[model samples]
Target: MSTCKNCQNQLTPDSDYCNKCGARVIRNRLTFGNLFTHFSEEFLNYDNKLLQTFIALFAKPEAVIRSYISGTRKKYVNVISYFAIAITIAGIQLFILQRFFPEAMSMDSISTEATKEFNLKILEFIQDYQSIAMMLNVPIYALVSKLVFIGEKKFKYNYTEHLVIYMYLLAQLSAIGTVIIVTAAAFDLSLGTTSLILSPIQFIYIGYALKRIFNLDWTNFIMRTLIFICALIAFTVIASIVTGVLMYFNGDFQKMIEAQKAANEAARTVKDTIN
Candidate 1:
């Protein structure tokens, strides 16, 4: 008999892993080659759970989601792990943009100096705390989904289940967006332009996934997608209002106006010099 190092379970002499804890029976001492091999098997292998989950979600989101919801968890990566990976990737994307392509994220086209500063600050804040922002959006997305799909009886899903759906959808979208952005950056593409192009694509994919999950027909899918868009717009407006109020309290609003006037005068002086 052999004792498992991880859980002290007794195993047959030739067992490759512990039957109780599933830890590999590492008879050999730890070495760099074995460590690299372990890393490859965990992450880079085509049979790895993460890679399998990523492909399956794109190919058949409905099946993966439904299976997970129905208590079939082992086949795919869980929702929390998937979302965590998305956040990590998103953070890396932001870091790359800030570090390598600072000009791409710069708001140079805006006319007012104060407004530009304010906008840049907002952008910086989002980039700095993007993980929190992404996590916060997940629940809001779940709420929006619940509102849109409240009438379904056959696929009656509660609030938490809706969270699972959006977590998967949003994580998948984030992964896709990161790949697209990174590729675009390699070609010296404008980050803002790339992001704008991705907005509609993200919406379409979200709708497609939902359609698959609910088995919705063309008419229902279109109607629901429109409603989802409207809900998002409404949420955006409300959030803007709240943010504006906070800025006003902090005296940023008044400063912005004064700065805009100064910027305008400066622009006029430059134009006069050229003329």
Candidate 2:
């Protein structure tokens, strides 16, 4: 223990500065070198620990979640941080894939001018409405999951636990979709059809993960899976319809661009005839 010279406040031996008056407290025999050393010792170490924790998290998600809920949270990253990092990585992959993959962006090499216009409009609408769509999806998924899990009290997981599991599944699904989009884009493969097939597979993976994570029986798992799948299909259909309507209205923007292109071509043709 030590005392602050200015305020005469008692301080712990481990404290570098006085809490009461902000006076610098001397460490080990009041030596300046000792103070610096003590301060460094107190605050400057743990890179390896954090790395190890992340490794465990990636390798053993169920164990990590169990540990977290069991009050050993400080040993691993918070769930929100994990989700954020996963989303960021997925987003980057999607962006890169879109930049490099021509086929993923378009269905055919020679899309009709109208179809091209429609696709561009759809892309623009996605950019504008993505956040709203995500927000809406969350509550809808929660409600659907809750309803699906009802009467399955044998699983021993609460509604909130199920919700967290759904969230984890959603994050994983998003990441996988990002990878698929990027890869399809790189190969010039149209993702429209690929997405359709991949959606069900993704749900299957989610169901498997949920079963393992929650120790659910096969019958209950399949029932919950079907319910979730139905919810997903409904959500997708609704979203597609909404986006299609928006794109229909937004088509005029693309038409103006096409018109400008045609006008320029006509002007060039006239200039060439005169020459």
Estimate TM-scores for all models. 0.92, 0.57
Q: How many clashing pairs per prediction, in order? A: 0, 2
Candidate 1 segments whose C-alpha is farther than 4 A from its true place: 107-115
Clashing residue pairs found in predicted model 2:
101-185, 103-188
lDDT of 2 by residue, 1-275 (tens): 66887899998878888999897775448578877876666445454433444455345556665665566776666666555655676557646655666446553343454465555555555445644544455566766767776676555555566555555556556666776777666665675656665767776666666676667878877777877788767877887688676645878755657766886799899999999
Give per-model CA RMSD: 2.1, 8.7
Highest lDDT among the candidates is held by which one?
1
Model 2, position 192, has a per-residue lDDT of 63
List model 1 lDDT by residue over 216-247, tens digit each: 99999999999999998999889878888998
lDDT of each: 0.87, 0.63
